[model samples]
Target: MVDGTKKQSLTDNTIGALLMLNASKHGSEIALREKERGIWKETTWAEYAEEVVACAAGLEKIGVKPGKAVLILGDNRARLYGGMLAISMLGAFAMPAYPGATLDELKHFLGEVEIVAAIAEDQEQVDKILELKEAGAKGIDHIIYDEARGLGFYEIDGLMSWDHLIEVGTHDLNEAPGRRDEILHRSKPEDPAIFLHSSGTTGKPKGIVLSQKNVFAAAKNGHDAGAYGEAEEILAYLPMAWVGDYAITVAAALLYRFTVNVPERQETVVRDMREIAPTFYLAAPRSWDQMLTTIQVGMEDSTRLKKWLYHFFMDRAIASETRKLNGKSGGALEPLGRLLGELLVFGPIKDQFGMSRLKNAFTGGEAIGEDTFVFYRALGIKLRQFYGQTEISAISAMQSPNEVRLHTVGKPAPGVEVKIDDSGEILLRSDSVFAGYYNKPEASAEALEDGWLRTGDAGYLEENGQLVVLGRVSEVMYTAGGERYVPNYIENRLKFSPYIKDAAVVGAGLDELTAMVCVDFEAVGHWAEVNGVPYVSYSDLSQRDEVAALLHEAFQRVNKAVTEPLRLQRFVSLPKEFDPDDGEITRTRKLRRKVVQERYADVIAALYDGSKEVHVSAQVTYETGEVGKVERSLPIREV
Candidate 1:
């Protein structure tokens, strides 16, 4: 970690100044790209500067000023970045709300701060604000929209198109050419630059206040660490509200002068990724799991010879990669096996997943299964994990390739100090620590004690300085017999099976542990087809004797490897997957343990009672805003 004095030295560079520096150094280089209608549109650094300047001027025309809060809700796009920078230029706080936020979540965010104006991505976002206004939400006086589709007829007051706002700013710029520059020059590094809302897996979301210096320092450390370079490109596919996107996509791009590519649509991201093939990449555990499932499912339909060849090389690659992860020279066969595997198996897999050019591939947000982690590494991808939180600008410890370990999140990041309390809670002291939570001084004080930020995560530092993060302190469960265990660790092991999409370990005060599992719809469905089993829906498939047999086999394998009191006694597959929209998980894809426990109380009781099956009639919401009941008698299987 850098000394405190060195950390303080970086507290002078505001995000706006960093963008200006990039513009000055590489004015003609492409700084951003957005895929539209299957084509990439580039924006030079000079164009980036001009767009931000115009956006700042436009926002000023709408009465947004220094100290005001400006909310941006959208997918990752060029305009969202411009809007954020424009807010920073005016010394206003840039708050990005998740595009998928529920109406209640949006209302809470709106009520947290004095949001004077907001820049939304399209008509859908505009309608959300309009609905809130109609429902008595106030404080937002202006709304600027980027996409005009399905919004041509809305005659709402204070609603303006992004193009029109830019035009207004251009008119103002024509009158006073240096007005935008003047505002940016007056900005201070200590001023609050952005407000990131926590994922709120535990409770209501807190508005995390991040100063310009904090954002810059975090990104600068990553830049200095050589995580990415000026020539490196990354896909901005993650949600814009996420702190990692702000640090990796916005601040890092400005500091390193790299290109940020925004995908056209979230559904099309994987296909577009194949075309862009970015050099730098980061994804949550769910995404990685989904990619692996896709590959496995696709292979199920391949010819017998092809399947034989894939398994042959895949086994060799795993053997070779396992040695590298353990910091050992493998058996003599490993070297040749890795060579043949890379030439025949790993190379093709990497190319198909659009990771052939990936340099700094990272997985975070949750502990990825060791099997999942090894699969990517075995396929010759530089997949590593990092440990972080929203309050620390999203980076605390990151994996370094040379000293990487599958079980650890590598060493602490540059300029970051990590310490574990007696309670095993990880504490971080860094220049990039957030200033405070908005309007929550008492909570802020509890989180930030002295110079350290209490991360709320239970973890320990290895002798070699790598950080091994367990699950959240509050989420770790203890049995009636006083045996303590981390649920996610066990759940991750179960989820390592390709058939399982998600699993919630339910033990707490119970005598033995059981899991509520959600099957991977595609993977399990294909398995049933290949095995000549017939099923109509998820509920039907989950109850099939054949499906239970498959899960029982997987559970028995996991149970055999389970150590001591944490062993799984039984598990039941749920008829439906956990949905964020249903409040079972957070928007960031984190399971809300309390909610899950309460929602599945019946299933838990049935499992403990040794019931053969529990009849369930649950309400489910469809994509078209219709609600329906799904009834089934899901089987409970004992390992």
Candidate 2:
């Protein structure tokens, strides 16, 4: 338990706390690497620090004072980390805006933030900011572009390239000898450090303001878990826009002297992961889900002999981990059986999934299937469910090695004390927790009560103190028959089927439950290809009768998983997949029911009614500047 204002760890400085250790120990080692044009470019620790110092000096030259809000927009790159550290060096807060933010949303964020200066990924982000200024946004007088690609047209001389700024910094260092100490002196233990926005799960984006004290406290849990250790190389492939990646790559990994590797793009993550074979890894539930899907797909094509061998080893892996979790070796079951399983199933499968070297793995963001949760645990990955929000500085409760339970999200982290309120809402009080939402004191007050943050999620603590998460309280619903249910639970059951990618179930005051389902395109398409089924596009395949029948079977299986009262009566394939850009899903990948309903109003209506097929006539804007109407009778069926 952390009491008083003092952090548990003896470390004081964020940069000096971590990166400095790396530089002195691995002076010439590659501290960070970013892939460009499919080639991984390396920068050593010394080089990285020099650049960070220079960038910090350049930021100071541009009138960025300590505690000023400095916004950053970028992909996973060295500059993003360097820029953040530079801002920290000045005691300024760093706010990272998602690179994927829409033009309107980006403009809104720019206007909302009282930015002293900004560092953009490249010319595209810079151009967008310039366009916003032209359209009359105020308070953005300075800009820094990391990559100088395609900036020739801009005559705005106020902007500077990151490399050029580095040169300017080297010359300025001699003029201000005690600059580092002065910057350090300005930093207080409780000063605001980083600002990150949640996916707006309930509404518009809100900035979570975390002080150095907040994140530093949370880092203790990660550190104690051995997430950061010597000779560990970690893939920083998840969105830099996300706090999960920021915590691992920029905060923990950087502080602990572990090498951080950045992939070129989303598509190259698998390759980058394999090449790195990172000792420690963390991913959202979706990433692990897709990884499981890929493995299952490969097994589907394997010969009977191979498939049997794979399952045999998978069994051994589970047995091994189970014994370990129970604190008993249980004396190896058939020494040769364990060895054979390791060679055939466990070893090869882990290597293929790029987790062979993984000492620990973590999954968060959303609830994973029970099977999905158990599969990794049984494989000895030490992968566990960690629960928290951006408001808690991202870690309140994290599952510890072999202390994991498939049904619950483990116990509270070291510094956190969690309690369930009258409504079964999880409340947390900790130093790791954020102070409040930026610029919304009332909203902050509403979220916080009696010094504890109300986590909106409904759940309870087991006798053993493990936290069992129910769905979000706001997402609960009632039937006209007086039954209460969380749609996420029912939908999760349906989605466990291989054929069903996701389901959106609705039955508030309705006679029976109905659903809109998104098919697993990869699984279904591959099945269709093998079955010799004909299809043109996604919508075409989704509307086919054969696919409808297959999904009907999926619903039947899902029905078997639940009681008759909870079973879905009617279901229809969604014409299109829900996407983050479409506003049907949040960036964190949680579904936005309101957005999905608004976009697919007819589909939900068709499911409820007795209609077998509903003709959908909707106008869609094309990439080539054309407006076209998609008019088709979408098939709807009842199981």
Winning model by lDDT:
1
Show where candidate 2 strays beyond 4 Å: 1-30, 37-39, 225-231, 299-308, 315-335, 617-630
Tens digit per residue, CA lDDT, model 1, 107-221? 8977887889999999888988887788888878999998899999988888999889999988898898778678657688888777888888888988898888888778766
lDDT by residue (tens digit), candidate 2, 167-191: 7777787688987445434566576
Which residue pairs come into collision in candidate 2?
18-255
lDDT of 2: 0.75
RMSD to native for every prediction? 2.9, 3.6
* TM, every model: 0.94, 0.90
> Candidate 1: where is the Cα deviation over 4 Å?
1-11, 300-308, 331-340
The per-model lDDT (C-alpha) reads: 0.83, 0.75
Q: What is the lDDT of residue 46 in candidate 1?
A: 83
